[model samples]
Target: MLQILGAAHGAGRLDPDEIDERQNAVLRAKFVDELPEQIDDLPEGAALAAELSRQAAAASGTGTGGTARSGPAPAGRDLAPAWKGPGGEILPAHQGTGPERTRVDIMSGSEVHVEPGTPRVLSYALMGGSEIYLGDVLAPGVQVVVETYAMWAGNEIYVPPGVKIVDETINIMAGNEIGRHARGDGSNGVLVLRGFSLMAGNEVKLDPDWRPGPAQLGR
Candidate 1:
């Protein structure tokens, strides 16, 4: 059941809220019969095959529901405060400031390629992950704000050589790491990272073997 929810999220078929809603329903079910009936209630095309499979299993009385697990709770919607701007105004879900700047909100997963001349970015990740690729060159004082909340959520920013990074992020049971290859000589530009992370991690690295593919380049 959880696998179906994960797949739907990965395919962009379900947003975080819907995922959480269905997950809680599944977790709270008291019988195998309740599982398949709830599966039938999912949005169209979200889990057709899973619905059929679970229905068959329930008909066979394979197992009951609500079994206890011995680990941390499954990843779900976070209760962190809404992301706010520097002035303390709540930022919208998704928006772009200009042609060269963007605000990204990630719940399941996403990837972004930073184009040339782009100056700033606001990124928020909850219950999922995101990757930002900074191209080979950057203007001076480029800034990227990344906030990740909840367990298993993370962000990875790839930087090119010769570019320096200044990180100013608050972390609670979370942290950021800069890879050895990403250490810069301060000759290209300074990339400032700002934001907070809770029970998550952020990484800055220079992946020498990685390059944007055609799809990412086109975007």
Candidate 2:
């Protein structure tokens, strides 16, 4: 997808902002099925889309968006979070035990990338913000939980395809923006996002437009 966007930029059809959007889409795309939708409208995008379709077909010969796991499976984990920082924290492959947890304090922002072997996560945000990116490393039929708390600040969660979410979050004078892709049955893993958003704007979305720094979490 990036290659196609680069070609479009070289052809003088896409501006910088357009290229950035397309690149972000590719990076945030969690499944092959979501790939074509990200770049099927730009110049020479038809060819790109066709190429992507071929790639998807090759990847998922079973046509389930390649959700099936081949070869031996790794050991599952009920991951426990080792408290890190107020800055971005990308979770390493699953290890350890206990309840997965983390926190972000005043004026700070952080990120947690969901990988397989890890279990439920508990996160806190107070006068600060955080972001969670769900990858497709989960085992089939496995459900992972993610709990969050946001107060006087904003929080964003990005989900990919095939993953299921059960959002039992409560809000008090706060706002939330949930994207279309975040809704689904418990087919894949379950991301039970339980939290409180008070006096702030919080969001649970799917494949959000990616950006740099704190801007990635958006407003």
Candidate 3:
């Protein structure tokens, strides 16, 4: 069980708080029946969880081969239905107004160039870094959510001129810095940033030199 949790954490599938909570539950279990039957937070961990339950039941002499104990599910196992987008893609927990583009970086670096059609951008960084560059001319009401997790992770958002940036990100033992930029009077829709940095850093600034051509801006 510890191995499974470790693997999930190392793969950036589970956050530090989740691993800590699950490990505490495992350590406090006095009997095999008290062990967790499933990792409810992990959408794809059902099979492994079931196998662990079956093995635990067999080892405790509560059931024979090919048979496992059956009872009501443990508390906290009931999760709300996941949010899905128009195309059936699962969205983040705090998705605001829905995002046209979602960029994720895990243990690596990535760059995302926002175009005209995309009004909302969701950028996630886990144990890695991500740079988001806003187009020169942004549509009205453009919003970007930059989330960074794990230690040493960072996210950078480059804002061009004539755009008002609204910072709404929460930082926990993390740095959230907004560099000086040419302020706009909200003519172009305000760029609202919303997300949290957990033991990480997120920087929002103006960069005037990065001008990527249309060919470089892939969907």
Candidate 4:
């Protein structure tokens, strides 16, 4: 699947950013059924389908396309933390390289203000919760990716109004509740949120009513 996307990108059918997005989707895909959507509208998607069929035949040892086995999914990828602050400490707002800054909470909750200009974030919460406030300095047309995991916990993500949002979270006895609408202005960036929620819930809000404290103002 990635090979086909690479070919499309080399032929100018996909740009660097789109290629990156599709590649990420491919890596994050959990099943054969989910694979088709990632390349559905791409230029060489048909080839991907054929390739997948061939692989399916090989896997089944039947050399025929029948009912494919739906086995247990592989374990989730271990992403690095998103906040580097000490445990239980409120993380101040500051510019960062997205999710490369790790945030891990075992049994406590913390707050964070992510400065704009980053394109990606990876986070995890276990038996705890987090509140992330996005900064307002993002560039137009930039696409930001925020992936997270919540087990027996929840997350509140505050996004600015001008950006577009896509929710791709997969839930297991849990789900996400989005409280904002996509912006009509095409000049804003895109927020791509993907991850898992197990016995937890995640929230995405626009211009959330909550305010930062004096210590949480700036880094």
Candidate 5:
């Protein structure tokens, strides 16, 4: 009678339809990891791709309408400001550490050439009391170039934190009137307390990415 019971219990181990839920789950996960991901090299947007091609020319300040030259402005007009606001100060800040950490590192290199060079000119309108900050370290391994066009005399500008104003020689071929905009020296922390612009022309380059931090740790 004991042998009979033992034989009946052992029959369960011989069944071929038994399934292991844990083993199936592991196999599914491995299959997912082995699958290939699709990446699009050339997207459907022609506008953005054109900008990347002429990045080198823009940064070097050597492309069409890229230079700023000397000028004798009308009365009551002043040139670019070389300082910041009365109480302005440069601040240093970032997001987080480890996974949340971000860095702007632009792998310096020449981009594709702009054949027949039709460079886009930007127009921005900045009030006299407003300030501007140029940030470059949010993306990691990147550099940025900013440009502006004049509408009315937008002077008395103020530079904010994370801004490095650089007056580059990228516009050697641009006309004198077109070249007399603003300037910066490519420093780490700079303040532009004065400038002139129109509307919507305030553009900035992001070689990597950009991340803005808080002013200070609460009082």
Candidate 6:
């Protein structure tokens, strides 16, 4: 199958001399998903995807066709932020990367806030350093205590009483973190939430008492 695909790549257009040979070989390598009834010869799924790849490669001047000439997919599986999937597609595996930073000028009594639609992800990231607090309040909310090695996933950050999650998703209520305990390491293996979907006029808020604290390191 591979060799046959290679031949198609080097062949520019269909050669009358090799037409019969190429067609026979391609037909043999075709993957079986659906078989044509009554028709003496028909292409299969593998043949189709391969043909598309080939055409794309040829158009790009790769001079090759089908599987052999195909380019690599974008790195990062699923096309999500945290983890990547086969062919390097970024899949929705971790929390959103938002509210990149929240800064405040206590000295001048000034505040720089990220609108609720700013940052959404609350990565359980401790790699660059422990949870960071950048803004007006010394610590508007404590970092949610989580295990650096504990099990977790990326989804909605359920902010504690003192925190607010702001991302492209719906506005998380003040005093509450929408996505709590996100996975930073390999274990943040799933995509459970794509941000909050809220009703208009209704508000979301964190409980009056819940506070964030540094997560305890696990054994």
Maximum-TM-score candidate: 2
Task: lDDT for model 1, please.
Answer: 0.53
Models 1 onward score TM values of 0.45, 0.52, 0.45, 0.47, 0.19, 0.17
C-alpha RMSD of each candidate structure in angstroms: 18.7, 12.8, 18.5, 18.8, 29.9, 20.1
- Model 2, range 73-184, lDDT digits (tens) per residue? 1122111111222353332223224345565656888776765455666667788877777553332345566666778887777764334566687888976676554553
Off by over 4 Å in 1: 1-107, 136-152, 209-219
Q: Write the per-residue lDDT of candidate 5 for residues 1-219, one digit (tens) a residue.
A: 111112322454312122122212221222211111110122322333344323423444466344432233222321112222234432332222322111111222112211111121122332321122233221111123223433422212222222444443222222112111123222223321222334312233221122222211111
lDDT of each: 0.53, 0.55, 0.55, 0.58, 0.25, 0.27
Give candidate 6 regions above 4 Å deviation. 1-47, 59-70, 73-219
Q: Give one digit per residue, the lDDT tens place, for model 1 in 1-219.
A: 555555565678777677666655654443444454444544543465354444445445463332332122212311111122446432222212434544444567677777654556666677676677775334223333343343447778777544567778777887888875466544335667767778877788764334432321222
* Model 6 RMSD, rounded to 1 decimal: 20.1
* Model 5: how far residue 88 lies from native, Å: 27
TM-score (C-alpha, index-matched) for candidate 1: 0.45
What does candidate 6's lDDT look like per residue over 125-189, in tens digits? Answer: 21121222222121211122211110111111222222323333333332123322222222112
Stretches of candidate 5 exceeding 4 Å from the true structure: 1-121, 126-131, 135-142, 155-164, 168-219
The better candidate by TM-score, 1 or 5, is: 1
